[model samples]
Target: MSAATTAAGAATADEELRWLADGRRIEAIEAISVSAMARRLPALVVRAFRLGWRIDRGAVGLLLTCQAVSAVLGAAGLFATTGTISALFGPGRVEDKLAHAAPSILVIAAAAGARSLLGITIRTVTIHLSPRISRAAEAEVLRATVAAELTAYDHAGYNDELEAADRGAEVCVDIVGEAQNLLASLASLLGAAGVLTVLHPALLPLLVIAALPQGIASVHAARVQFLANRATIGDRRIMANLRWYIHVKRNADQVRSDTMGEFLLAKYDQVGRRLDASSRRAAMQSARVSVIGAAASGLGGAVVWAAMLWLVSTGRMSLPRGGAAVFALTAVGTSLRGIVGYGADLFRTGMYLDDWSSFLDTAGGHRLERGTETPGAPRRIAVENLGYAYPASDRKVLDGVNLHVERGEILALVGENGSGKTTLAKLLAGLYLPDAGTVRWDGRDTRDLDPHALWRQVAVAPQDYARWPLTCRENITLGQPTAEGDAAVLRAADASGAADVVARLRRGLSTLLAVEWMGGEELSGGQWQRLAIARAFHREAGLLVLDEPTAALDPRAEHRIFQNLRAVARERAVVLVTHRLTNVAVADRIVVLEDGKVLQEGTFAELVAEEGGRFRELWDLQNERTGVPARRTRQDQRTVPDQRTRKDQRTLPVREDEGSGR
Candidate 1:
């Protein structure tokens, strides 16, 4: 097959892989090999240290110093205890032995007290540092997520990756703690080993032998758990979304209306059971490994005891020195096991941290196109043979399509659902860079101009406009907050029919818009649409793209919006994508799209005059449904009366019955 075909196939496979990740089944992530993990451990440690250090350098340094000094104190305490034991058991008078042992006992006490103080200091520093590190990491993740291109949200893989990364960020503070503990444990283990070597050089080798089995087992167990977690991340993300849909206030009504409580509850139970079963299996495997490790450790301890007895019997070692060696050997073994356990924990935490790092790379790779040149408002915007496909999809949504819009012209794009009209509009608005064409603003390629600068000249009202849960004023002035209460804000609100909507509010423009909030009110669908249009209008850009702007409006409100289109277009270009054919009748130009291609383009009258055309067929169909005559003269195009009065606007009033809210 050709290279394009191969790429398309790869994309299809990737999409299929994502499709399988719906929390219904376990799909294991490819496991990292032991060798690979070993190689990556050093890098992960360095990264973790840097992550912690960046948030609070002083605290990290202090924490490290405390751990190092505490380890040294630990070794000193072991040595002091050994000396005290030897002195007490030596052949001498009671008073002499007591005098000899007293100094060593004091040293032991001082070392122990110092270690305890250092431990307290470490805890204090860590407590202050964790939240700061967590916040910083969280901020980085949020920044990367928000700055990513809009197209990334369309793919399940991207969202799953982001969710995984978000989860990792949440636990990053804990990972830092784990790293610190791991280092501290390593120091303790080394201190014990040093004391063991001092007591008897032969005993140090026995400590290593005793720890080998448990170390292997701990690492193996960690790997098993890590694999389980990695495999379940996508499922966990799906579960989170489902839980949100069931419990969040916004989705409550839909859940009740559709009787989805039982269905969603069943889904929850099903996923939960699968996860529980997976957890049980992983836990069983780890337990088995631990048992085997315990057995090996007991056998190693027995061997060391046997060797010590043989040395004592042969008189090769003194009884007092041998007893100290045995004690040091036991301490070394315990500490070594703790170090291994901490190492396992660090490996697990490091893997999760890797998710955060991987997500940053993944999201950052698909950055918004950036350029150095700033662009001015365009007199003409043109698309040349545009072709585009969504991420991880084989089929192109727009293909070989060309179009143009200029100042003072209203271009109406009318097409059926899934006909690429919205996609074309996004390309025109510079929200997306075309895969196989150029969008030019005033004869200059938009790719060469800064995207932020280019977007300033364009304003868009998307079909599914966000209903921000803020004050009405804030929502309307979102794009032009600095122009709030200015003549322009009011003018845009008036032009979009939002001024009348705002007039009916209890608190007027300052009223919050979320029904779930105290003293807040919800707007009717049409009113919200009007507010979205107001937001777009507030931008006062040179190019305006309205996608189904009046879909929820009543006949009169819809008519009022189209009636003002000529005035709105007089100062800037307008691209209107709508299914309402009646609204298209007044456009200066009409473009017809079918199956990702431009089927026809002309004046509305010219298109209607043709006997056979997609535009005419759609117009005829709409006329039949509405029972309205087409080709109406200018005198016949009068605005309809306001069919929807005050009651139609779902505004809150200060009356007792209305709960004194808006």
Candidate 2:
């Protein structure tokens, strides 16, 4: 009793903590909290450096080379200036000759050309590598998401994952910038030191004292800025979502009818105000950091300039050389500033880099593997006592669930909300694993079978299907288990409803999608659902599990499509999940489910004929609700098997039955 009480207390505490962390606004505020910003700087910088080396290899090499050239160019520009001063003083005989203007022109031209070429080359290299790096990062993330178990996706908000993906897409740009700046800064700093060494080796110590403090302070400042940005992400996304709702056509009428414009604007203002506060804090922190940096620069420049003034007064740095020393001092200041700027950028990019790195490092989800062998058609599938719960759930969603599917028959699964109908369908489709039960194909554990092989024979149109913003031809081919060749896409599109869609599309199969960016127009919800079905049809798999396949379809369309599906199911086994009982009569057998357990199973005629059974209650309720006659005389209500005499186990949903079914 004591142990149980302790466990309950712990659970209560955990729930409270989770509730505290859950709100979009509250979570965003906490995420970007800057209290420990300084602590993460070193890690962030390190992560940015690693991404440069890993994803943008060519850009990174070019960055290093650019740094070297920039240093050389700085030295040359210094040399050219020195040559000018020498020409005035006749200190070097070469400078006296160059006083004729020809040599001076060549020196100026060389310095200008080197600087221009370095900038152009670095930009070109970074741009050239950006696409490849972006593609690789996106691919890695997609692969990870697909391979991971389904639970992760269910809990993560759509906006959160999308933002993460956007960050992944920008990883290349951040990587290139992080690397180029670091190299450029280092080069500039070294050139500054070299020029200062020539000016007066004694003053170098003061320069170091001034520059190093700012570099360290800049790193700390960057951390605070990143934290502030994080704190605003949640609230920012909410405002963005609100804006989307207001602007979208479907929601426009609803918004106006409900007078939601002011509500949305208020929500936006609330988030925006918090964001403004966070931004103000960040700006203040930045101002403080800047003031410190400026003070250090002023003190260092003053010491160097004062020393130069002293030398000039003492005839050490002559009038012309003293001017040169001042130029070098200015260059040193800019170089020190560059070093701090680069260090700060590198530090900030580190956080983005770590996310990108972790995302890319992930592999093995929903990826094509060599181990998958070609699977042939299965005669039967049996699920024996299959049970599962999600990763973070304490309650078992599917407890002692058992099911079976035979070749060439339709099975209808009926259940209340959250009764594990969809979960069972996913398990049967091999998209999920059974925690304690065995899923066998012809009595062999499916674990031994290759997943790719299994997928080739199965097609599942999920409860929530992806409406890819792609061409009509591409959409249907996605239904296929494998990537189809161009010719196959053409053929698949022809069979599905996509051919009609293609005709309407100005560019047909090549048309791009999205009003935000390209040539394609948005599809209607009903149209999108049809397109999704077409994708499944194109795949031509033997096993099909459809959850609310006609949920978005009009009644006439839904009725026709199911008729078409029954005709198409001639050579396949279909598992259908739906809330409506109208089509339940079409299945070979009906399985009644409630609270995640199968309450009873039988043909519609067999189950409905029984007194007060769950199926009878549901059936009676549906017919009564629709005012449909209980007795049926038409042949349209039943399915007859083909001439081949297997068992009368012929699966067609029956509205009224004489009790002759499997």
Candidate 3:
């Protein structure tokens, strides 16, 4: 990369890193504590269950029922074990004892079988429900993104929030399994604790004491990993972006020709190494905590076993009850360990889900809030004292600008790069609202109109139009076909010079535009630009905006587009923004902009007649480069009316009168 390019990339990377680190959830993770996790755990579990219930209530209901039944069966099996032990000890003959124990053995087998069946049912329901929960979460994210104002994308923080929410959506499915395990573990612990209480109240407390250390260790390990993940979020994002640049097909040629593959790979490795270091530190810390906890837990278990022996020796618990205590203690201990492990996983997942939920709640803090007024096709669209500055900047892109366009007129915007030509065009189309003055359709301000309803009357062929990976027909119509259907699409294709390109496609208008797909085809740059223009032409709107519309077209195609421009403008107002001054000859009037202010405005002939004007200077520069004559003859210029007489005939300023088709 050039030095300037490298500097720009570094600046962007720094901004992104700052944004990622400033995330609300990242800040929360930095200060994470066991007490905070405990407080948040209930709300997170409730949210997960609510989400599952909303997506598929039947599956959620089935899952809960199965868990409850399985817990009951587990408790019954423990009770049956106690009965069998008691019967065997109460025997006269060995044969008599075995016979008496048979009924209890039968009950134990039945309970075990039922519990196994219930476990299978729980797993099946969880599998059925998890994906739907994920899909619902993802869909909500998409909806919130779409509802946000166009200006929302200008903020780095908003983009960072979107990335985090996407990760949260992806992990949403894992929460379902975590929740099921947590609930099952809790239920099992309760059942085992109850059985042990019936055997002896003293033994229930022993079970908790034995499991406490391991439970604490599990939770601490989970906290360590979660914090590590949060710390590396920015680095992971950087790595993902680098991988895309190195792996995408569009960059494949540049990678080889510029010898950038190794450099890119090295950058990727650098980011990956940072992430790996964080992971290693987390793993070692977790291991240390686990080892210490295990040693403490071993000591606790010895104490519990010794207490049980003393109870049995003192006849506080009989031999039959002692055997049952062994089974109950094992069950309760395992369940407690499971409860801790699953709870920790669920808490971590819940933190990520909070990102998703928070974004949906605020809609990236830029959700659209426009008026309810629906506008029809406007006869005249007006701007007065318009000004705007993009997010995160004080520099105004368009300041104190005034302009208008009416139906049946074509107004051209001409300027050097960064002169706000495209920004002005966007403002006129209601894609953005001005920071200072009003843009109005007829007499109503744009802010007073329903945004979607207003946009329905506008069509745009932007400088960087999307190359939709869809069928040619869908690309042209943008998935909104007219009643005329194919006839309308064909007419638009012919007008934009894309009919020839479509005819050469393997499946004509049905051909897919992405080459990566099976049986799909790709288009050259010029061909894609033609399709983009056709998309705007296909829409039956009251206003049409084309920015650098012919930038990629050949001379003949460019000529054809300008030749048809006046006819297209006969039905709707047209705003044309381009650097190709020759094409502006077809415009009814031209406006020159410099540094966010209008420098000149007139008919093409009038602008050309002004000797030292910006337009004439640009025209002369282009003429010299193309080896054409620098100026028209005096008599040729006289053929056009003088600007003095034209101004005398207008009652309003040139900006409004010219747009009024005077």
What lDDT score goes with residue 562 in model 1? 82
Q: How much is 105 displaced in model 3, in angstroms?
A: 1.5
Q: Write the per-residue lDDT of candidate 3 for residues 361-417, one digit (tens) a residue.
A: 878788888899999988999889999999878899999998889999999999999
The lDDT ranking, best first, is 3, 1, 2
Error of 2 at 607 (Å): 1.0
Clash pairs of candidate 1?
none
Residues 1-662 of candidate 2: C-alpha lDDT, one tens digit per residue: 69999999987877211111225633443354233344554455455445556776666677667768777887777766665664665555665556654575577579768888898888877676656666766776766665554544544343354344456456556655655666666666676567668867866677766676676567657767766665565666777777899888668998999999998888778778877998999989988977887787678667767877898899876676676666677777777677567656755665655445544444312232323445566667788988888755888888887889887788999977888888888887677777788887777676666776777778777767886767666676763435546666655445434456666877776665565445467777776777777677667677888888888878876776677777656777789898887787788988888877889999878988988898788777777755756676446445555345447656465545455452
Shift in Å, residue 477, candidate 3: 1.0
Q: Model 1: how far is 306 from its true place, Å?
A: 3.1
Candidate 2 Cα outliers beyond 4 Å, as residue runs = 1-67, 83-109, 124-140, 156-162, 311-323, 363-376, 391-393, 441-453, 463-473, 479-528, 552-559, 564-567, 625-662
Go through the candidates in order and give each one's C-alpha lDDT.
0.80, 0.68, 0.87
Q: How does each model score on TM-score? A: 0.85, 0.75, 0.89
RMSD of each: 10.4, 13.0, 12.6
Clashing pairs in 2: 32-231, 44-350, 147-365, 147-366, 585-653, 585-654, 586-652, 586-653, 587-653, 588-651
**Which candidate achieves the best lDDT against the true structure?**
3
- Candidate 1 at residue 198, lDDT? 69
